[model samples]
Target: MKPGTFLKSTALLDGTFFERSVIFIVEYNDKGAMGFVINNPFPRKLNELEEFKHIIPFPLYLGGPVDQEHLYFVHRRPDLIEGGTPVDAGILLGGDFKAAVKHIDEHTLTGNDIRIFIGYCGWDDGELDAEIAEGSWEVLEGGMLL
Candidate 1:
């Protein structure tokens, strides 16, 4: 398993949720799969946006074709949070609108250290495994999922 890689759900096909979308899998296992969309970008910057201006400063990415109005984020700073699980050795993913705003207001966090996204990519049980066996997905190992 690589640190950053695109993992598409085999169960997601021809739906309003995930059509022709590529998701960067942040976590995966028997429990489930979690990821963010890489190709879709939200045209608004958080700092200038009315609702998120006080919360985040980063430009949001369209995490997936589903729920295009929700907010999600991935963070890498573990020192700020006590006992946060690492996505890798040094990377972590966690954020809420309130927490993000508080961190930003206090100048404790920066957009460079995190990424915001709208919606998310998900997979049900045994769905991704089938795709892996069918060779429809390619896994990569590196710093980021790009």
Candidate 2:
């Protein structure tokens, strides 16, 4: 698997953290692998959080089972958001948060342009490969996935 690849959890992971989850890979290499669960939406919005209460209310998603206190984001607006690392094609991971907030408040950035997440999923070394080989996930390819 590579960056921008989507991994759909199989029935093998039923009743687990990855049950029926769809993950968007942001980094994949010899060192490790990391991704966000694109299909799981968190019930709370940004405005409900103490730190982000000043920011506009925006939908938040449950990225995975790690780093729940921090925020992560994926966007297609590198031109508008700036400093984003490309996952593939036009998709980007992280960027200038100040600029993102500015654009967001100014109505330049919308939900269609970015997806914010709390936490992320990660696998060390060959852990992901082993899981895939065991049929825990089905890799989906082709086209840009937001």
Candidate 3:
């Protein structure tokens, strides 16, 4: 992986999207990319929302164009769940869904501690690199380098 790649649990660089939008990448590989929009803050609250009601109070995100209904999250606190992989300093990605639900049920996790997102942005293999080469995307260090 490259530096400033956002890794797993790191927040998307600021000013990269709508105001205050923060994204967390969940899966990144040759197949494509996937993550959640953590900071978008839709008009609805968790209790008032359906679909992900099982994870009440967990903030929702605008992941991207891929699977808008799919759910994903990123957390820095690994002790709260199992199966998470370390992405970078102070960040952890991926985890057991049941563990996460238990944490939510027990009130051990909150929106600030973890972010939930629907949908995701993606690029087929070599597509991202091509975008960079074509100047459609810019690579920068430390935060959203548009």
Candidate 3 regions with alpha-carbon error over 4 angstroms: 1-4, 7-27, 37-39, 51-56, 144-146
lDDT of each: 0.65, 0.89, 0.56
**Structural similarity to truth (TM-score) of each candidate:** 0.69, 0.95, 0.67
lDDT (Cα, 0-100) at 61 in candidate 3: 59
lDDT (C-alpha) at residue 136 in model 1: 53
Residue by residue across 43-135, what tens digits does model 1's lDDT show? 977677677566545667888755667776777665564444456645666645566657766778776666778788667767766767786
lDDT by residue for model 2 over 1-146, one digit each (tens)? 78999999999999999999999999999999999998888999977888668878888899999999899999999888879998987899999987887887678999889999999999999999999999999988774556
Task: Candidate 1: list runs displaced more than 4 Å.
Answer: 1-4, 7-22, 54-57, 81-85, 105-108
lDDT for 83 in candidate 3 is 79
Give the worst 10-residue stretch by lDDT in candidate 2: 137-146
Candidates by lDDT, descending order: 2, 1, 3
